[model samples]
Target: MDKITYDGIRNFIIENELTDSVAISLHPDSFDELVMDYLDINNNQIERPFEILGIEILQDSTGSVQKNKVNILNVV
Candidate 1:
């Protein structure tokens, strides 16, 4: 998985014309995952346009989860 730099994320948001309401809804960690996945699909090394299919939260019912798992779906 590639790492999404702060600048890369900023550029993506700007290009997409994402409003504050939409941007604020995204989890901070999910942003990186979303960016990297988008890059892979487009075969690009930098930020570009993409659409979010959905955002999912995968949690452990065992009550031992140290961190939450978030899946950012970009395609069906």
Candidate 2:
């Protein structure tokens, strides 16, 4: 992600007081292992549903940052 997007997300998390619930994983299998690992590592036993926004940013031929895929995962 670019600096602007990163900063915006960071600010949103901080302002909403969701620092403990959000995690960023850059690996290919981020959704499969990283999310689970984060939950286990943090011992987060959240009873309610939480959302994970998976953003895939890529550069087009013109070298502009483009958002390719956005997947919203609701984990209960």
Candidate 3:
């Protein structure tokens, strides 16, 4: 599957209000698995823009997760 784009996720978050009242993203370091873990749609829809970023998935030893830095700056 194609890696989820940053703009795609940001747009989804704004439109669906998924981030509303949600303090942190549930994203993990293994972002690929997160697609199925959080999204409720079928396989065909998994790659769509509606899926939110699971940023919090990358947790540290202290159980605190950092913000998503992968595509944040569009360095790639």
Candidate 4:
């Protein structure tokens, strides 16, 4: 699994113009667990609440299971 950093995720949202959207993960396996782990690791450093949108199964061009794609939404 690729390491997804907090800064990287936040920057993605900002760069993609998703400032008002909640965070999301599109991985069938352990998407929630990954998000929780991320939060647990950076719990003390972060102040603002980062909400998750939802989870879905994502695939690559070759039809292989790809890494979870994190997105955002305006509400839950």
Candidate 5:
């Protein structure tokens, strides 16, 4: 799996024009865990965003499930 760092993730969202795309991870996987882990490792802390949008992650097939591969749908 690719190492998605804080800057990498922030850049990815910016590049994708997803200022509102982040907030929460839809899936209960290591991606979110990794983010938290990274933050913990880096000793970084962040407050919740104005709108911490929730998501519904659609898991993929192949019997090889991953959190980062989740297809996120905004929570209405």
Candidate 6:
């Protein structure tokens, strides 16, 4: 996806308090379509504009997942 589209999806996830792992369920074709569909339906009601730079997987010393580290920035 393009930068704007990707950023918009990231912003949507943040706005709805969803995690990256959520994509597992809505994968491949449906995820992007869902985001675009939601944007179209809601007329892009993204209250907070933000850019997701990256998602860092934080694992413990034993290699178990501790939590996810989302690198993000507020967009103007």
Cα deviation of 21 in candidate 4 (Å)?
Answer: 4.9
Cα lDDT of model 4 by residue, 1-76, tens digit: 2544445555555566564434344444444444556667776443334432222212123324345555332344
Pitting candidate 3 against candidate 4, the one with the higher lDDT is: 4
Residue 74 displacement in candidate 2 (angstroms):
6.2
Q: What is the C-alpha lDDT of each candidate?
A: 0.41, 0.35, 0.39, 0.43, 0.43, 0.38
lDDT of 2 by residue, 8-69 (tens): 44354455555333333332333333345546745865222333333322222332322422
Instruction: Per model, state how many residue pairs clash.
Output: 0, 0, 4, 2, 0, 0
Top-TM-score candidate index: 5
Q: Ten consecutive residues with minimal summed lDDT in candidate 1?
A: 51-60
| RMSD per model, one decimal | 11.9, 10.2, 10.6, 7.1, 5.8, 12.4
lDDT of 6 by residue, 1-76 (tens): 2322445555656675754443212233433454455467568853222113332112123322212222222323
Instruction: List TM-scores for all candidates, in order.
Output: 0.30, 0.25, 0.27, 0.40, 0.43, 0.28
Clashing pairs in 6: none
Backbone clash pairs in model 3 (N, Cα, C under 3 Å; residues 3+ apart or in different chains), count = 4
Model 3 poorest ten-residue lDDT run: 67-76
**Model 4 misplaced regions, further than 4 Å:** 21-23, 29-33, 44-65, 71-76
Better of 1 and 3 by lDDT: 1
Clashes of 6: 0
Clashing pairs in 1: none
Off by over 4 Å in 5: 21-29, 36-44, 48-70
| Candidate 6 accuracy as lDDT | 0.38
User: What TM value does model 6 have?
Assistant: 0.28
